[model samples]
Target chain A: MRKIVQIVLAAALLVPAAAWAQQKGGVVIRSVSEVEVKQKNAEGKEEVKRVDATKTKVLPGETVIFTNYYTYSGDKPATNVVIKNPVPDHMIYLDGTAAGAGTRIEFSADKGKTFGTAGKVTVRSADGKERRAAAADYTNIRWTLEKPLNKGAKGSVTFRAKVK
Target chain B: MNTRTASIIVGLLLCLVTALAAPQGAAAATAACTGIGNTASVAYSVAGAAQTPVSSNTNTITVGNKVDVVVTTTDASPGPAVVPNQVDVLLHYTITNNGNANQRYQLSAVDLATGVTTSVFVGNQTVTDAVLVSAGTATTGDNAGAALATTATVAAGGTLNVTIKATMAAPPLTDGAYDVFALRARSLKVDGTTLEANGSSTIDSAAGTCTADVVLGDGAGTDDAVAGASPDGSHSARSAFHVVLNNLSVSKSSAPYNDPINGTTSPKAIPGATMEYTVVISNPGGSSATAVTVTDILAGTLTPVTGTPTWSSTNGGNVPCTNQAVANIASGGWACVGTGWAGSTLTATIPTLLSGETATILYQATIN
Candidate 1:
């Protein structure tokens, strides 16, 4: 009986230590909004400038940009990083806007259950006919990293949506 | 240093610059963004073990004002015969709000009076609730009969009805008095100005795409929405009233009289002669003639005797002529005789004479 009790206590202590090690080698993510503005440069030429989105009131037919930033602040390398975002109501996601280097972008028409490339994701139309999902039909977007994220590495992904 | 040695040194320096300018630690990543007011999150695995996922804050946007309305009138040509000062005309209108939001429409009217020498008299404006009518049917009668509303309420995808009535003034009407009835509608804002598209106000805008009520455009202004052309080929409405007068004819003849001095009888003009005069009246138009009166003047000094005037149809059917005061109108009596006989004139009155119907009067007058 004494030998069995000593074995259980050792196993419990080992498991928590292992979990703490895993937690120390993790990544953190944050998101921010940006807006495109046109202003005249010193040469009097109109130039586009990206600035923080500060507009509290947005009208229909207006477009806004959302960017997700990720940083691996861990003691070990993070692998197979994935990012997913749902499409909001009263807005239309701009087609072909998801972009990042060395990353594979996919779209989901059924929330985030399954994902496919453009013209591959299929869904039933209002008439119950099966057809390829359009950009407007995309309900979620995902980005899959092709390489591991080393410690102290940072990257960002951006997409655009227009108010309906 | 020699030229070849200098060239070798420059090549080495170029190679070093290229190596120094090479991209450092730039990792390729895949990014995708799509959706409105969606949640964005990221997750990763360390050494093949999944880590906790992170989520983004919710983001959202705002849709403005959309306005639509339709107005229409039922009758195109409401053609009917009317006696001047004896008929009231009624017109019907329908206003509909086809938008997604509730709306109020301001109402008004226009009298085209097309080809009319004198304008029609429209009064006692009354409106009532009504259902839509079938094609080619005239709008008449008062369902509600309240005063015309300056503004009418209609829910989105709903309809409201309006009815207007006007009376025709008395005679001096032309044979073909034609006119048009045009009804105008405009959307009013809370401030009573025109509504502009996408404006914050639900009522109306200061400026909009709708120009005239009858103009086929958006309903941003009062003049922007209008009832379409009635079936009568007018944008508003069309009506014609036939006006005409009735006619009459009269004649006189005498029988033989006995001369007191010669004790011989001859059919010659003499005093105390019983002369018979006959009068005929007829209506030859598509309308009935009412309150017909006939007055005769004497060529010579003839005295009207106290007797009932005989009345009959062209077929010789006779109706009794009763003596009553001329002021006693609407007395169902066949005819009215003069109360007291007078010199040089006789009179008769009949209540009504229908189309193609006639009345005859017979009485004797003695020459003085």
Candidate 2:
């Protein structure tokens, strides 16, 4: 029994320290939306109105604003903070809707893994001819912060897409 | 065989068998991860350290409860009424659920306003409510007045026709009197929540609850969070109805008079004899007839008489159409004879013939 105990302790010491290390710092992401509404004004002219999109139903061919919020709740600042959002199915990303201050916006034709600025990203056609990708060709959106996000600091990036 | 050679052969066979069976076990282990969840991962780096990656807890995006609808009236201008007050005018409207989810809608009729003249509905008074009926098609059905049952549900991308049978006001409304009817619709949720009208919401798959349902975006962001216990909400619109009438028709006849050979009451055409012509314009509807003008064009072969034409109504009362205005119209048409007529034409302008009334014009012309 003494020999068995000695061997068990020796085996435990051989395990890597990284296996038990706790995560020190991280970020949290949340998403929300806004929708456009049209109602007749007192003069009976159609006026555009904005409304909350929570639990709201959207029709086909309508526009929706999708915002992704990111907050750093870590012990240390995080660098190269990049956020990515895939365009929802049955929706087309509206051009010029991506907006985030101090962030570089890029679009992806491939699923969120690779991104480039519009007119710079090139895709090969079925006939093997290469052409600059249009904004409508984007399937994913990415935002890379210009500065490191300090702990407890938050920022949001938004874009609009139209229901197909 | 040599022992060394036989042992090597046995070892090679065993290695081949193990390689073939290993992939089957790996494939079985890989097939067990089918579940409902979303995946999100974020990566960051610390000073002097390589980037570390952390994956979010399995989150889910639920299908949002979005309610959008549109209501439209069928006709803009309905015309040519056969009779007023006796005819029940049926107006049609279609309500469509233009949202992304199924929904129930409540409908009601609001009153048409009085003398404030507008081209479309602008008032909100609930008048004598008309009978509302639901039908599969917009046409070919009649239903009595009753509140639409609460259970009537409209699916996304579906439409329903609502018919309002408005009984025309008694004592016959005056011609050109207008009334407007407005149709209103409100959407209801199964949880008894009235969804906002003509609105929509979207769920963020990365931030929404992938593990469980979590409702967010409560009016703080662009998305309006539906207040779960709020009152039912509605969208409103209006349509107008105008009073008008069908026109009256005119008929003409002739008889031979003072004939030396044939009888004076003969219906045949004759020469060297006097002929009497009668023009009758009748209004058979319950609406007033406006701009009643009768024109009689005589052939140049017939000479005009020296006397004025006599006019009468349905009650045998003679209309004093003594003076006439002879006007040139299109060819093959008739004009009423008047004092200024140098040609073979006759015309009488009688304005404002009341409903259910008839007017007649009698003139005399002789054969050349």
What docking tier does model 2 reach? incorrect
Single-chain TM-score of chain A, each candidate = 0.81, 0.76
Q: How well does chain B match by TM-score in each candidate?
A: 0.44, 0.44
Q: Which candidate gets the maximum DockQ versus the true structure?
A: 1
Local distance difference test, each candidate: 0.49, 0.50
DockQ of 2: 0.11
Per-residue lDDT tens digits for candidate 1, residues B1-368, read 00000000000000000111111131201001112344678777665556667676654322222344555655444334444444334455566554333455555444443333332322211122222221224333324421122444455455665544445444444444443344545555544444323334432212222221111124332222323322211122223333333433334444423233332344344776545555555566545666566666666766655554332222232434333212122223233434323455555655566666656555555557
Q: How high a TM-score does candidate 2 get?
A: 0.45
Worst 10 residues of 2 chain B by lDDT: B6-15
Candidate 2 stretches greater than 4 Å from native: A1-85, A88-105, A110-115, A122-136, A142-164, B1-66, B77-82, B85-88, B113-130, B135-151, B166-171, B191-232, B249-368
| Tens-digit lDDT track of model 2 for A1-164 | 01111112233345545322223546787666667788899999999877755444344455777777778876666777777777766567898889988899888876776688866777667799878877767888878888887889888888887655
